[model samples]
Target: MSSTAERQGGSPGGHPRGLYFLAGTELWERFSFYGMQALLTLYMVKQLLLPEFAENVWGLAALRGMAEGMFGTLGNVGFASVIAGLYSGLVYFTPLLGGLIADQLLGAKRTVTIGVLLMSAGHLAMTFDQLFVVALVLLILGSGLLKGNISSQVGTLYPQDDASMRDRGFAIFSTGINIGAAAGPLVTGAVAAIWGWHAGFAVAAGLMLVALATYLAGQKHLPDTPPRRHADFQHPPLSKADGKVVLALIAVILLTMPAEITYPMVWTIGPIWVDSYVNLGFVPATWFGSMDSIGAIASAPLLVMFWASQARKRREPDSLGKMAIGTGLVGVAALGLAAGSFIFPAKDSVPLIWAIACYFLMGVGWMYYWPTTLSLVSGVAPRAVVATMVSGAFISPFIAHLAAGVIGINFKRMSPSAFWAMDGAIGLAGAVLLFALRPMLNRALGTDKRKDAPENAF
Candidate 1:
């Protein structure tokens, strides 16, 4: 049988060609983003925020004063965590505005293009000490524009009725994300180790250019952006059912926050932890940042197959259940870190295997929740507000990062074991809440009727 994509004149028996193009574009974009991110916290703690170097940055004193005013006498590490948190948080938050612009004013493609240019400029700016704050502002704004619109475009590739294919497409797209994420830290970390931080930033800038080129190359294959909504245009009011679903989705986003808060810590404070505690013969700590993505990439196919087999037996998990499982696994991953910390103590370096295991588990947990949630939102959100809803889903991570940053400030004060255990407990709490709320969510989202065949039902 000709697959839906094939029937729609996409790649024969596969997905739309545009899917690969979008995935490719995103791969390089993530490569740039993650590459820079892998360096940011470490750079700040080790060099950039130090008194001598900090003085060279144009706005450092004022920014530090404002941060200290808000948070109260932050040490260098705490201050870096706060900045990292704010940067990560705002990147997710801005997508809401980006979605509005795409859905109402500029359309997805043009907005994405503008985003690429701004991000490219941002990456370039990262190479200069004077532009540190400015670079972050640009990257945050650019990412806001690119992230949601590109994701929404994936949904437009397949007919809305083909939920299964849409899910599969997202999985494939996520693979690109994992690959780039896995590679970014390794490459940039190695580059920084060999040369300097600015050299690493330059590489990220180059990668962003490649991303832009890939996006432009594939313009002909992408979906036509809908005409911009006019000032007088009015979407039909959302039905009462959609209103309920919206509320439920917002609840779901909130429920995911516990795990979200714990996950980014793997990167934000993770490198610092690894550098201080892990027994690395020669490997840079930033390389450890790749482990979660590596784990996710390795686990995706096996999980898909496992889910497929379970589906045949009518015992597959619903989206919420899978997300709960994912959340729990993330907790377990944090506990693994806690265990390592306890066993090794602060005086002794932790075994390399412990960090590897923890990061890998976190990745596996990510495979279960992140893409599943994206597919769920894309499949079920009301069409008129789909883009906004998709963007809003990111708000979970936004809140999580902000909270995580605050939590990260305590890393210096707390024992490593206590710190990780707290994170573990938070993740487990989220899982418990998600599991408890599953039935309620089902009814609210109108998926309760299809409970018997939930594998493909969502």
Candidate 2:
């Protein structure tokens, strides 16, 4: 009975009720995740990593001395970047192991459950100075389980044969992510500004609990995870064409690292830059994180329409071409920041609107590439290797964060323009490389064939 119910497709409304359930689950999960993230680096620098914190509290002089000795000559921004970079990077890497665990041992539902629980506990633990490391470990492990599985389950909610609807479903699902992204910083940042950083973290923890509750309430609606059998573990062999496509994708992912790095770098440290340079009287730095989400949400419907119109006219860019443009846009976003820095040219902060503008451009860039890449993989990879390609997609962030962390170390050494200019160059290089490879990608993946309906705009 359970299996039969799980096999049931979309509802009378032509979409699955499960999609809404999963979307709600993801919405709250992201709410908690980004909320905590918005505060993390600031919290670390203000409360944990700096000498001032230890100076104010008793029996902490040794800790302050240790940090000062270890991070010599690097300013607070650079030191904070190291910690943020490692934490952000490791979060992506854990998903690899989490995916394996979900496939082999616990199943998606159970793994996601465990992940949510750990994440909730991690957020709560952040209130304590002594348990900081433990908190990070729990959050990383939990995110690993929840992130991939929840997304995979969204695919399971649809019938196998309905390709068009499935793509639309993912598009709808992604909007939920953007909604959370926009709201998290606003709520958490405001809370921190009023009460304190610990309060902000506590709010994130509460949101995670809400997410857990939401998921559990919709448990009956969610598809069941099939038990893994040893004999069923083997992957089907990829054809020569698929093999070439896979290699092409690998190259693409490597080149997109600079673009990927922009996300974590901006969210973690962009606020620091804002705080140092921008003299906004009352605004919280974390509010800057919302710009990307706000831009994405505002432009989603518009972009969908634009793409659909282009597809109808046979003028829509291919996945690789879109990614090239997206990559270039991220560089353009960095350039925006550089422009603002030059305009200010003093120790004082520039108008907050300038930073907001940069974030909006980044949001536009993200909208083009991030969601599109998933569909590209689904469309291009052979059915037998789809799962492999999806898993491979996760590797981009893992590599991205590691390199971003290394990049973060240079924060203090370079001026704002120089730092951003460097990122801009990298993004442009990736774009040029992908543009050169577009012909090959077009042949391997074939042109977009879903012109039958505009609803397939994902």
lDDT per residue as tens, model 2, 1-458: 25423434555446677777788889999988888888887887788766655344333344335545765655666666766776787787788788888888989889998999999999998887667767888899899989888899898887788888888888778878889989999999999999998899999999999989988887888878865877987767787877887887777667667688865567766877787887667888887767788988988888889888898876677677788888888889888877888778676567888888888888888888877787778767777778768777867878787677668767678888777777777777777877887766656565434444233322
Instruction: State the local distance difference test value for candidate 1.
Output: 0.88
Candidate 1, residues 299-392: lDDT per residue as tens digits?
9889989999888888788888889999999999999998999999864389998799999999999989987897688667898777677777
**Model 2, TM vs. native:** 0.90
User: Which ranges in model 2 have alpha carbons more than 4 Å from their true place?
Assistant: 1-12, 52-73, 233-235, 444-458
Query: Model 1, clash count?
Result: 0
Clashing pairs in 2: 277-349, 278-349, 279-349
Could you tell me the C-alpha RMSD of candidate 1 in Å? 3.1
Compute the lDDT for candidate 2.
0.78
Clash counts for all predictions:
0, 3
- Model 2 residue 357 distance off true place after TM-score fit, in angstroms: 0.9
Name the top lDDT candidate. 1
**Listing every candidate in turn, what is its Cα RMSD in Å to the true structure after a full C-alpha superposition?**
3.1, 3.9
